[model samples]
Target: MKFKNRRAMLWHFLKGNKRFFVLSILFSGLVSLLDLINPKIIGFTVDSVIGTEETALSPYLESLILQIGGLPYLKQHIFSIALVVLFVAFLAALCRFLFRLFNSMAAEKLIKRMRDLLYEHIIYLPFSWHNQNQTGDIIQRCTSDVEVIKNFFAEHLTNLLRVVLLIVLAVYFMSGIHVGLTVLSAAFIPVIVGYSFLFHHRIGESFRKVDIMEGQLSAVAQENLTGVRVVRAFGREAYEKDRFEEMNQKYMNTWIHLMKLLSAFWASGDLIGGLQVMLVVAVGAVLTIRGAITTGEYIAFVSYNAMLTWPVRMLGRVISEMSKAGISIDRIAYILNSPVEEDPEEPVNAPLDQDICFDHVSFSYGGESPEVLKDISFTIKAGSTVGILGGTGSGKSTLMYLLDRLYNIEPDEGKITIGGVDIAQMDRRYLREHIGMVLQEPYLFSGTVADNIAITQESTEMAEVRAAAKIAALDEAIGKFGKGYETYVGERGVTLSGGQKQRVAIAQMLIRKPEIMIFDDSLSAVDAETDAKIRKALGERTDQATVILIAHRITTLMKADNIIVLDHGRIAESGTHEELLSRNGFYRRIYDLQSPEEA
Candidate 1:
């Protein structure tokens, strides 16, 4: 649940693949060792076989050569030395292949694990977190930031280890020829590393800026696509285009600036590396002429020096790029660190038949914001219908949200209970499973009509889907479609009319047949006759369920057993229709406006 650092977090996801990762590093070291042997073979051939001089093989190497017929045999068949070099090259190539294969496999597995964890965490996170964060920014972090971390582990980290090992091994072999030249070659490494450290430290801030700008640009584009209809309705094509272009230009400029910084660092590294090589070559020529070292030794040392040059130079760039990964890791860590919604330690089960009570409950959206609901007390008895009438911002929806446990209420503020048990102590999933709600704005996935209707059920039964649709007054409209229940709804149900989408959502909740049903102004889009028919059908079908209806229409609630009127976060009036009409209160006024002929 808690990771000590970014590497710890990565390792957690890579637990099963750690063996492959270790093998890859070991193979990389093997490849470097095989490569280092080639120059030594070339030097030995030059000294003993090609030139008129005694062989200078180490004791172990000399014993091995004797087994293959000694110096005389090598001199007679010179191609044998070529064959030796080819054999070493072949092993080196094989090791390199295995190294890459293992690293790729580990990297891909890490990526899949990371993506799965991020998505699962996002869905389980508290609703308030989603309301606070931008969709595009979160998506970018889940995708782009995750990729950066993967590359860091699979490529950058591996390469860092490989380069360091190669440098250490090369220096060890070069020291066998002359310690002075090896020291000279290694002297520039610290300078390159130190300079690179400082440069990357400064460049990290720039990379963060570029990453944020990219997320912002992506958000603008995403918002535009999602609200394409609104944009066209307002005739704001040119406005949206200009806005996007401005963000695009800003994002481009930030990346260009980052590239400029990278170019300067690379150019500086190249200059230092070039000088180091020049010093090595100049000193080796002096040592050779003065008989301090042999021509063969001098040639092998320079070859080793050449091998180390690029890796040392690349070390600086790798360190710099690694800093970018740190920023990405921190970004990903933010999501992983956020607290998930927690269930009570001792959870209570929701009763199948019970009264739902809101006992002096009040709520706010937190952080010094004004309260949205205040001192709200109401009760819906078992197997009864209750109506809620309120204007916009009257907290009708917020009240239902509390009952569903979408948001929690503090002990000091109030409590809601079901069947004499506090709802807060109930398991959230268990509580919501028994309570069905149809929201004011319905969202449907891209699927067939039957698929949308039966989404809440574990298995789709065509009969039940059609039956629910009939109760919601949606079956006839669905039948008219070319494919009927099989027709695709498109993204967010863009293919369906507003009335049809609401009806489909109603059908979805109806299929569940929950103990408590809440309709938060779910019938506003349908015509009066269709609304009445659906209400009539719901009344006949859901007689045993506790139904709480929130509607602005007086006609919708006039026939309910009881109705409560809300105004400005408080209950303004509550009574049956005839009782409120006798009192001439807020409910009576609304009834008058809705039915002036009867009034």
Candidate 2:
């Protein structure tokens, strides 16, 4: 789950696509080598053809010149020399093109792999981890941070390699012309490199601050967009706008500070580079006048030194940009390093169609927090209906989450079981597949009504979808829409009323045909008539499945075979409706509150 460092993590991600980057580096080396040849040819032409200096080309090149009819033939046909220069230029351009192409291919593949892995890892992460992290912040890590890493490899890292190689080779070529001039030129490199390292160290913390501010800005925007409806309903649009603007301004200020630092670094580099150029030019002129180096050799040496100009400047830029990559990599690693939900070591697909037991189960959301559910014990017999009544914060939903294994209870706290088999030992995927829960605030994906209902199935079957909708008492509502079952539900089912969304969710679960179904206050949004109708339909269809209903409504739980009332974190009463009413306990108190007119 955790990587030792950035390099180890990068190597892990580079698994399938390293070959493409290898090819890119190879082509880039070819391009750098090819680029060195043109200056040599230009120098050779100037010295031999025009000035009558001895041909100083290497033996292999001299042999090629002989094949092309010797120095006298070249002097008469000087254009042939131009043709050779142009040929080298064309090959350099071709290699440059291939280098970029392969580099681009590698970058795209690397980003795709990163995205796929992040998405997969996120989905499998525990619910507790999700609760502890913010949605917008996580999104920023996945998107913006991932992009920074892509640029790191494709642009900065590769550029670093290419520039370093070019500088070394250029210096070597310059040394061949005049070792003294080469020494002077190479001396400036250490200064530039040392300055770049200093700048890199200083700017890294600045980039980190900027990146953190950007994530905060992204979170603010995401929060506003998601809760736009709440802002509109409360007439707080102006307040929300001000809030976003404040965050945006902070983000902008941080970025401006970073840019200012970068500008200073670049401007200083240019000044140093210019001074180096002046020294090289002044010294080379003296050497040429003294006849220590010929005019052609002086020009070629200058050309090679000129090549170092961009690469030297770029070396600083690349190193500074590389600092941003470290920040991004750590951000991504935070997500990847978080442990994912793992199955039990020896998991079993236990039969869930049996008595569901919560045995001495106690839970706290955090270690130091008060227990949400304390010493809780209950049972739902196989193929029977049960109801739970609780007030807000009575840990009603928490109980269902525990049964679903969304939050595992510590071994010392307690255990839950179905068919006398501990739920902890069951395969998570298999357990969840057999237990269908419809939550209070139903979330429907952006899809047709039929699609939402049939989401559990691989392929949508209209017949099954319609049947599920009928049981949830949603068929008539679907018929009212022009598109009926095909009607598009907007984001989070915003297009549907609260009751309608609940019905859709109920229908979605019904289509799955799970052995155990829990309705976690799901019917509270619907009217009593619709609620009664849904209960009747469920009674007729779900004869063989275990049902556990949690609700605040007395009428909702009145018809259950057994009802348990949770007060605070413990059970206050447990009995049938008639028996509980006769006892005048917690269930009786709730019934009286709801049916006051009857009372």
Candidate 3:
């Protein structure tokens, strides 16, 4: 089934480049037919010029011309026939060359098409799927592994097609001259193909491991590069080097296995082909001597045998490459075939009026483990702020994710509703459209300040985007930039300070103007002043929106209408700022520790 999935993925990807894909194969097949012609032309020329007949080409020309009663320069015409044969051979080769060139270009176009399709799909995958998978693993799949597959397409795909055509045409030509020799030539096909397939399976396993190793190596390198500062701060350069070398060595071993399979594939093909040649020659020479076939005919047979060498041998090489590339194909298909997180039921687009409710909501991923969120009940009135404070592993963000229905598999236990309509019953897209999120470490795209701010909801007008920026308090900062809103940010907005990234993220969310805004400790990077200003602006900007702010800073939630302090996945205390402080529970202690002035 996975194999079928892989084929389906390839078809889907190639559907965009169907014309180029089809044309490339046809052209490669045509070129391979020409490949058969050169040897025949050479053999025919040899027989005509040096055969046991007198007057190389004149006799036939003279006979033909004499029959027409207009013989013109018979000797010169004979010489011209030889020139014509040479020219025909040259022209055939020229056509083959051009066909191969076009074929390669077409394959490249197909690679681009596949790459774009895969990359586009990746960006759209749900965060739940991406959260479980590593960034380096995904990156390796898109780059090195995909390149191996692309190279296989641009080179070996046609070569495989060419081999099939070459053998078919070669066999047809040889059989026309001598049926027995052609049969003898093809007798090796089964043995060679069988042996090559054995190596194919072996190499496929090797390459799959190679793919895994590549991901590991990429993970190490990517982590080290991204966290070089962390590495140096801890002062463990030698340990990191040893770690990298170990992964590199694992990759080297996988490479060795792949190389061995390639070598064995070629050797077995060549050996079987050589043995087949011996049998053909021994029988053909005896036939020649007995006047059953001419010396020239035997020469042509040798030419056919010579032509079989590359195709049969190349058959093995192509098989090996396909095995490796096939592993890559499956690796990529694993991603493509994975079921993305989908909404549980038909979505309701009703506007919110009352409190959000969690009726015994419980969830777990994959198997029977302790529930991540069990009997998680909640309520927050419309146009109010709700704060969730919990220990590190207490499902704080998980609760927020549930509101967006980011998981395909819904909670096994209960119902969560907004405006009396169950969230599970609401369309995923519509729910997300009405919700905005800013994570603890806000991610920014590689673009201008305006682009990152307006990413989720695109409006072409710069003035409109700046309006959101001004609300998030990023307007003054952008104006000071050399290019203003047009100023380009480095990758991941690495050039921007942490607080700046958070503000831009908030600006992005603000532009969306969702009915429910979720902040998963998003303001941790900002100074107290900026945090207070943005919170104030946010409260005003969304006077009718429900705001859920998750934070460790007690000051961040002191003014909230409701605060739910989570202790071991249950609410320890839930009330307004004054009520929770009076309770002297988790919220009270945290607040005291954070804001001694207020405490």
Candidate number achieving the greatest lDDT relative to the actual structure? 2
> Using alpha carbons, what is the TM-score of model 2?
0.94
In model 2, which runs have C-alpha deviations exceeding 4 angstroms? 1-5, 204-264, 492-494, 596-599
Across residues 19-76, which tens digit of lDDT does each residue of candidate 1 receive?
8889889999899899999888888888888876675667998899899998888999
lDDT of 1: 0.88
Provide the overall lDDT of each model, using Cα atoms, as 2-decimal numbers: 0.88, 0.89, 0.76
The residue-by-residue lDDT of candidate 3 on 1-599, one tens digit each, is: 13366667677656656666567677667667766665664554455444542223347755775674432443335565566667766766776776666666666776787778777777768876887898867877887767877777667887788788888888898887689888988888767776776677666666668878787798799899999999999998999999999989878987987887688767866677788888889999998888776677788788888778766765765777776677788778877766655555545677764579887777675455566776778788888889888777788878888787776435457888888888777777878888888877887778887788889765557777988888788888888888888888867443888888888888888788888888888888888878888887876763588889998787887788888888767667799888988888887787777755732
TM-score of every prediction relative to native: 0.93, 0.94, 0.81
Give the candidates in order of TM-score, highest first: 2, 1, 3
Q: What is the lDDT of residue 31 in candidate 2?
A: 92
Cα lDDT of candidate 2 equals: 0.89
Off by over 4 Å in 3: 1-22, 38-75, 94-98, 101-125, 139-158, 175-218, 238-292, 320-333, 341-346, 365-369, 408-412, 460-467, 475-487, 492-494, 539-542
**Clash statistics: count for each candidate:** 0, 0, 3
Considering every candidate listed, which one attains the maximal TM-score?
A: 2
Error of 2 at 305 (Å): 1.3
Candidate 3 has which clashing residue pairs, if any? 347-426, 347-427, 348-426
Please give the distance, in angstroms, between residue 245's alpha carbon in candidate 3 and its true position after superposition: 5.4
In order of lDDT, best first, we have: 2, 1, 3
